[model samples]
Target: MINNSSHVNWRPTADIQSLRQRAVIIANIRQFFALRNVLEVETPCLSNATVSDLHMRAFCTQFNDPMSPQQKTLYLQTSPEYAMKRLLCAGSGAIYQIAKAFRNEEAGKYHNPEFTMLEWYRPDFDHVQLMNELDELVQQIVGCEPSNRMTYQQSFKEHLSLDPLSASLEELQKRGCALGYEHICRDEQDKDTILQLLFSHEIEPNIAKQRPCFIYDFPASQAALARINLQDQRVAERFELYYKGIELANGFHELANVSEQRQRFDADNAQRRAFDLPPVVTDEFFLAALESGLPNCAGVAVGIDRLIMLALNKTKIAQVIAFNYQNA
Candidate 1:
């Protein structure tokens, strides 16, 4: 019932040749996992609970329970993380999943509301060991060399001549102002927010310009699900991979303490409430699994579309995605 003119824009964003190349890359990913004995996993795309991260928003829907004749709200999963961790707790060992994840209010040259995520968990591996494996995977996928690893503080010091951890709020604000983010209200922002603004505006653009790089040991306040470093309580054992100034992956030494996890979730919800955003319900099942005991593991989530973009030398994420959100 639609006109041909209107249908003209319905074509896929990626050409057939590009899609074929994408398929080969995906196959390579599966092969890489198979060679490492990591089990492939599949989790439900819908869940009764969603992440409490204040920065992330989940899509919601209602499920009509025929047996109870009631409607129950469900959320499209932001990632397969919660379910995958539950599996790990249930003795699935090392596992990986290439999942289609959804997030609300995300669409741009580098983002889509729906995109593929490559997530994995490795039991008995610390963040460093996981980073080694990640390096190998990236090299195999893109023929890129292994990356240099640096601490978050070191990166800031090297690039901006400021030690992020030791810098005062005023110093950070001054750095932000110097980086052309002078419009950012300094009085209302916390140290973490100011550091984030400075990093995004100044340091991040220059990182990994020559090759891929991993920045680790983030400030405790910026740790999402990472455990605090016992050696340095001020820092968390988290790392993010960047290639050509584009963020490619985020990983953490998984926080195993249930109480600490609960506190972090509560804090995130409180921040959401302060911002006048609806607070999300925390996943009780995930928490229970953690309480039962999750093994020492490190996990990482990679953006597949971005990886494809880098591999194929494409500029925009749409060049790798079959159909962007606008067309979808």
Candidate 2:
């Protein structure tokens, strides 16, 4: 951590020109939402509840009040999904937010421990329709080619000649090991995780490096908050948009069933227990909002730093942001 005692230069990671360019792109993004009449809103960045998704982790902090006897623990939100959904339940029409989000144990060329997130929810829109909107956003901002859609299963087969949906654990492991991942494969036992590893390592990098690609219909188990497809229960209505090997956005055809949502959260905790990872408390307030009935909607969270990186042709996420996590 760069603190008072640390001998580090106190300067912006991005140059003056990059900061100005970033400002312009963000201005245009706000205009894009304004033209579409999407209501811009803000939500509390710190909350009592954190995401229970198996792969997500929130930064924990303490809120100490001088008058209170206890210090309450609060979590830095990983995304604005829960709070935004509550707004939707409260009848906030189509909404959007450009906010700061934090995630633990994330820092690299493409990610930072803290980053900017542009999230939006569109009532009455399904994942497909949202993809169209997202494509327009990327094209207008980043000038990428028209996007393409490939299902989760099709992407695997097209790239590696493997069927991710039906492949058994042993089969998947064999394929992964064949791709020179035997060392990493030995420690991983989860099938969904293995598929993801293979995809990120081998498949994603080789996709259209310049154009946007949308891959949807992920395995049901991989669905964090997406609704299962009626046509094919084997997959969920989740979609991800990628450009130049970097995932730009993750969108879901929202799931509104309170009971099913609870079940999924429970399953995630159970898996955490099995993996020796600490379980997290589900957000009951969000559950109550779900019970109150969330209108049909499609929502997506976009990595604003990544989009800026693409627009400016910068290689590292640190090149576009004012301060990387290290400096912050």
Cα lDDT tens digits, model 1, 1-328, are 8668865677899998999999999999999999999999999999999999877889999888897778999999999999999999999999999999999975887889999999999999999999999999988887788898899999888889999889888888887877777788356367888888777777789888777999999999988999999999999999999998789999999999999999999999999999899888889999999998999999999999999999999988999888998888
User: Local distance difference test, per candidate?
Assistant: 0.91, 0.93
TM-score for each candidate, following the candidate numbering: 0.96, 0.96
Most lDDT-accurate candidate: 2
Query: What are the clash counts of all predictions, listed in order?
Result: 0, 0
Checking candidate 2 for backbone clashes, the offending pairs are none
Count of clashes in candidate 2: 0
